[model samples]
Target: MFGFGIYDALIIAGFLGLQFFLSARNSAYWGAIIPVLFISWLTWLLVSGEIKSILAYLLILSIGFIVLLLEWSEGRKALRNRREKELAKMRSYDMN
Candidate 1:
């Protein structure tokens, strides 16, 4: 199981949920906080030696990064779509 315990799994799951929530909020402050939290958690793990294996640590980091990237891209896509819709509405009004 790559040295992952129940604790590690639960923490990762929680972070994933946090990432999703922050992405959905789409605020500048919240957007900045996720990466900081991610880094702090990893640093704490490394310092506390909770995870012994290097492979396990890397795997955890990779999973977190992938989830964060996916959620961020999705958020951006949604924002773009919303902006495009608003622009279209304004253009229609101008034409009318």
Candidate 2:
């Protein structure tokens, strides 16, 4: 009643919590499970009449997946840069 729906608040909190956990892990690899995951949760929630729960879960899952992908790309970029530096050093040594 704080000028917002309870479900909306709950969803926001849930998303924040999930984001924190997933971001801390720095991987959205779990997003790979999301399609089947959301569907399964949706089915169960529907049966239980917990519609809001599924919506919150879906939003969090989607956001978390995207963040994970971003983290992975950054990691890959960092790794590539490191390897390139190593290779350049090796080539320089060969020239010497």
Candidate 3:
């Protein structure tokens, strides 16, 4: 078992708390912060000897990669939607 230091635990807790609060506010951008928080904390653990095994490193990397992928996918979708709306407006203007 790995024991988390007070500061480490506090940072994690803060991230989780902010995530929850932002989620309740219906802000999707806040969800992207999760990956940043996770990566930083995981890296800290890796360097601090809290996460020692190769398997653990691989597992954390895989999970972080997935989360990052999801975040980017969502962002791309939103960007595409905004572009479509802009194109639609431009087309409408050309017809008039």
Candidate 4:
């Protein structure tokens, strides 16, 4: 499937899992850094001829982008919820 072997499949799966975990944890720093690192590694692999198929590279890149978008949206939702909660708390204090 797209020139990916079993090991490559496993590595991609693991990377996706890591991305999900980081997103759930709302880790702004590592969430951004990890994808950059992965892209760099992917580039190296392509240049070194380890990954020969363009489709595989594009597939992996697309997956990474999708995960990043999910992470960004989730983070924004969490931040909005946090702010709403803080405002509610302040309003309650004012009422008391």
lDDT tens readout by residue for model 1, 4-94: 7999899877776666566656474565577777868876887788777777778878877777888766766666777889999999999
Query: CA lDDT of each candidate?
Result: 0.73, 0.57, 0.68, 0.73
In candidate 1, which residue pairs get closer than 3 Å at backbone N, Cα or C atoms, i.e. clash?
none
TM-score of each: 0.70, 0.48, 0.55, 0.63
Q: On lDDT, who's better, 1 or 2?
A: 1
As for lDDT, the candidate ahead, 1 or 4, is 1
Q: What's the lDDT for residue 11 in model 1?
A: 82
**Predicted structure 1, TM vs. truth:** 0.70
Number of backbone collisions per candidate:
0, 1, 0, 0
Alpha-carbon RMSD to native, per candidate:
3.7, 7.3, 7.3, 4.0
Name model 2 segments beyond 4 Å from true. 1-52
- Lowest-lDDT window of 10 residues in candidate 4? 19-28
RMSD of 3: 7.3
For candidate 2, write residues 61-95 as lDDT tens digits: 57755654555455455556767899999999999
lDDT of 3 by residue, 1-96 (tens): 456799978975675555554433435666567677677777888889888886887797787658565555655566567778999999999999
Top TM-score: which candidate number? 1
The most accurate candidate by lDDT is: 1
lDDT of 2: 0.57
